[model samples]
Target chain A: EAAVTQSPRNKVAVTGGKVTLSCNQTNNHNNMYWYRQDTGHGLRLIHYSYGAGSTEKGDIPDGYKASRPSQENFSLILELATPSQTSVYFCASGVRGPDTQYFGPGTRLLVL
Target chain B: GDKVKQSPSALSLQEGTNSALRCNFSIAATTVQWFLQNPRGSLINLFYLVPGTKENGRLKSAFDSKESYSTLHIRDAQLEDSGTYFCAAERNNNNAPRFGAGTKLSVKP
Candidate 1:
């Protein structure tokens, strides 16, 4: 089975504080993604990386940034966290096309 | 406008009953994926289809590219099956998959 693990499974932050969520995949998939899940919006992609040192903005990337320092690790950074940004975040790793993307356990973030 | 739409936003089923979930795509999707988000909030991949049908145990899923739709059938539902089901469509190999609003399913014994 593909292994994808996320750090700080639950987090609480104050408004304007900086927060970071980390993901590590043992599957060695080239593509990694960060998504936030809200009540009705489902999962909205925030950022994605094709490989190490590469990051691309997704549909809703305004409040988030992503970093891929190595093939096995990806991180989502919130420079100025807000209550609006409070949601469940998921990280996934997969190959380029037509393949299964393994997801992490997910992180619950609450901004006050 | 939603690019991917899922029908019956919420559903309830009794134990040993069956249910079906549907997703319609407005985009020219080339692939489809079905996922079940368990109560613990883990997204478990159920099926990945490429314009065809695939069955795993009591769950069967079909993706029709020509029709721009996909369906998931759950048989003999169990309490463990209670969760949110989501379907995603991929326009092409290079583009990211677009997800639907999801179907929240509840199974009771």
Candidate 2:
């Protein structure tokens, strides 16, 4: 089975703090994505990477940044975290074309 | 208007019954994916299609690019199936996928 793991499953941060969520995939997929899930809004894409060193903005990428340093690792960075950014984050990986995506366990963040 | 809209925002069904969830997309979707979010907040992949149909166990899904829509049908619902069902669409030349608000399903015994 494809495996995707995320670090720091739960987190708490204060406003204006810098937060980083890490993701690792053993599937060897070339595409990686970052998304945030809220109560009313299902899942909104924040950032995605095609390959190493390639990051593209998604629908809601205003307060988030993504980095794909290697084929196995992708990270989402919040330079200045805010209370509004408190939501469940998920990372997914997929191969090229219309293939099934493997998602991580997800990380829940609380900005106080 | 929402780009991806799912019908029946919430649903409740008795065990052994069948139900279908639908998703309509305003975008030109080339592919579709279905996910089930358990009560524990873990999102599990159900089906992925490119204008076709796929069946896995008690779950069956169909996607039509021409109609810009997709549907998921559950047969003999079980308590473990109670959760939120989400459909995501990916347009040609677009790597970012758009997700529907999701249909929350509760299977009662």
Best by DockQ: 2
Model 1 TM-score, 2 decimals: 0.96
Q: What is the lDDT of candidate 1?
A: 0.92
What's the TM-score of each model vs. the native? 0.96, 0.97
Give the clashing residue pairs of candidate 1, or none: none
For residues A1-112, what per-residue lDDT tens digits would candidate 2 score against the true structure?
A: 8999999999999999999999999988999999999997899999999999999999999989899999999999999999999999999999988687888999999999
| Model 2, span B46-105: residue lDDT tens | 988998999999999999899889999999999999999999999888877889999999
Off by over 4 Å in 1: none
Across A1-112, the per-residue lDDT of candidate 1 in tens digits comes to: 9999999999999999999999999988999999899999888889988999999998899988899999999999999999999999999998888887889999999999
> Chain A TM-score for each candidate, in the given order?
0.98, 0.98
Candidate 2, residue B49: Cα displacement in angstroms equals 0.5
CA lDDT of each prediction against the hidden true structure: 0.92, 0.94
DockQ of each: 0.73, 0.84
Error of 1 at A52 (Å): 1.0
* Model 1 alpha-carbon miss at residue B80, Å: 1.5
